[model samples]
Target: MATYNPIRDMERFADALLEGSTRGPRRMPMDLYRDGDNYLLTADMPGMDPGSVDIDIDGQLLTIRAERTLPKAENVKWITRERTPGSFLRQLNLGQGIDTERITANYDNGVLSVTIPVSERAKPRKVQVSTGAPAGVDSSEVVVSEA
Candidate 1:
């Protein structure tokens, strides 16, 4: 059985009510997945010109902005104007361990791909501790290793 959450439902209702008045820039759909020591982020931005997209990294904040302009022809009559032509905005806070300086991006077939590498300092490394006198404890103390 599904439980009803009033606060969540109310928030959705409020969003629907304000979506029309908010200038209607739809959020880009994003997929984030970790591949080994790097993260792959993909955003589906169909019909967007590759040159119009901008990626900015400020501190740990990653922002993506793109725009699609509607053709302006005086002779054209549109039967349906459902496709909204406006800016696409998406922002993400990259947590610690991300190598922001070496971040790379590519656009192909209306999809934006960003590769974020993990910093070497944040990668896991094995520390070898030989059996000997415990650093500060007794000289004949048991040596403990973390798993």
Candidate 2:
């Protein structure tokens, strides 16, 4: 005989509910990753106009909202329907180190790509070495430049 845990079952049920609520046509798929000096976010939004999408960053959270109005098909009847149409709202918690003001977004070919530029403070900095012998290198002789 196998033992059943009510707490574990409830947790699994809650997780499934959350996943189901975040799915559907209104809720598009998204992928976020760090690429070089920027954070890239790609979303799959088919049959949606670029102007209908809105992106907002508040504090350390990023929210994407979009709405789509489907055209009515004349003389068409559906026996089974799975596609849903409505407004969508998706939010992501960004790290405190992310620069919100430098974020940029673009929508094309049923896909949306957003690039958030990294701040100077969040980027890695190189440490300069002293070339001079005794009291470090002189200002006039040392030329420091980033690679």
Candidate 3:
């Protein structure tokens, strides 16, 4: 016989409501930062199957989706099942200056890392300044003044 606890039942109900099993995709925590010429994004997805991870980029939007499915067993009783299994999703708007075609992703040890490279045209570069000398004068005689 199973004992009925209202508090436990309430907790289960709340967990189901917040887990987003049927409401939609659950939000996952992620960290994004710029490293040198590339932007790095790492997301935490422990216990998630690597094959279930999906990443897509559309225009300026970058979306990440993954699923965590529980195993099935016959005649098994779960004790204090707390881990929520469902779809996880996250989207980020990557403005201009990003090399969308060069973007790469990798999943390792339950962490998904994405590398977004900065476009060549958006990189910082120094411009050369030249001083024009008169046609009649020697180019070496020209003096350049710094303001």
Candidate 4:
């Protein structure tokens, strides 16, 4: 007969419970990058429908929320369940130059991609220099003696 260490087993069980409890809807991971004139955000959302996702930008905060309902089987017994299926919510703080009105989003192959265009004022512009003086200026100089 083999004897198990109850203390170690209790520690592992506690750790697992803490990890699962902290993984509520606010823990979804995402990747963000800047490409030319737009910012791209990619989030992994497998088994979720595009219609169940909601994206909103208020001021400089961007929020992404999604909900998924797992299919129920009448008489199926689950041997193992690993993948997490639940609602997810993620919020990202955007920079001031982001143009919220022009933001666009697309979902494909279980990945969600959001493109936020930069505002015109935030784009770099070249300043034109004027070399010549005023068009109506006279080049001649007038000197008056003490009167």
Candidate number achieving the greatest TM-score relative to the actual structure: 3
TM-score, each model?
A: 0.76, 0.65, 0.76, 0.73
Q: Which stretches of candidate 3 lie over 4 Å from their true place?
A: 1-23, 133-147
Write down the RMSD of candidate 4 (Cα, Å): 6.0
Model 3, residue 57: distance off in Å is 1.2
Query: Higher TM-score: candidate 2 or 4?
Result: 4
lDDT, candidate 3, 1-147, per-residue tens: 567688998988997787656557988899999989999999999989999999999999999999999887789887566676789999999999999999999999999999999999999999977677645899887789999
- RMSD vs true structure, all candidates: 9.6, 10.8, 5.2, 6.0
Superposed by TM-score, candidate 4 places the C-alpha of residue 94 at a distance from the truth, in angstroms, of: 1.4
Model 1 spans > 4 angstroms off: 1-24, 134-147
Model 3 worst lDDT window (10 residues) = 15-24
Tens-digit lDDT string for candidate 2 (1-147): 446677876876785577575345345688988989899999988877678899988898889998876777889866533345566768888886678888898999989999987887889989888664547656688767999
lDDT of 1 by residue, 80-126 (tens): 35455788899999989999999999999989999999999989899
Sliding window of 10 residues with minimal summed lDDT for model 1? 77-86
Off by over 4 Å in 2: 1-26, 73-75, 129-147
User: Which whole-number lDDT from 0 to 100 does residue 95 have in model 4?
Assistant: 77
Ranking by TM-score: 3, 1, 4, 2
lDDT of 1: 0.86
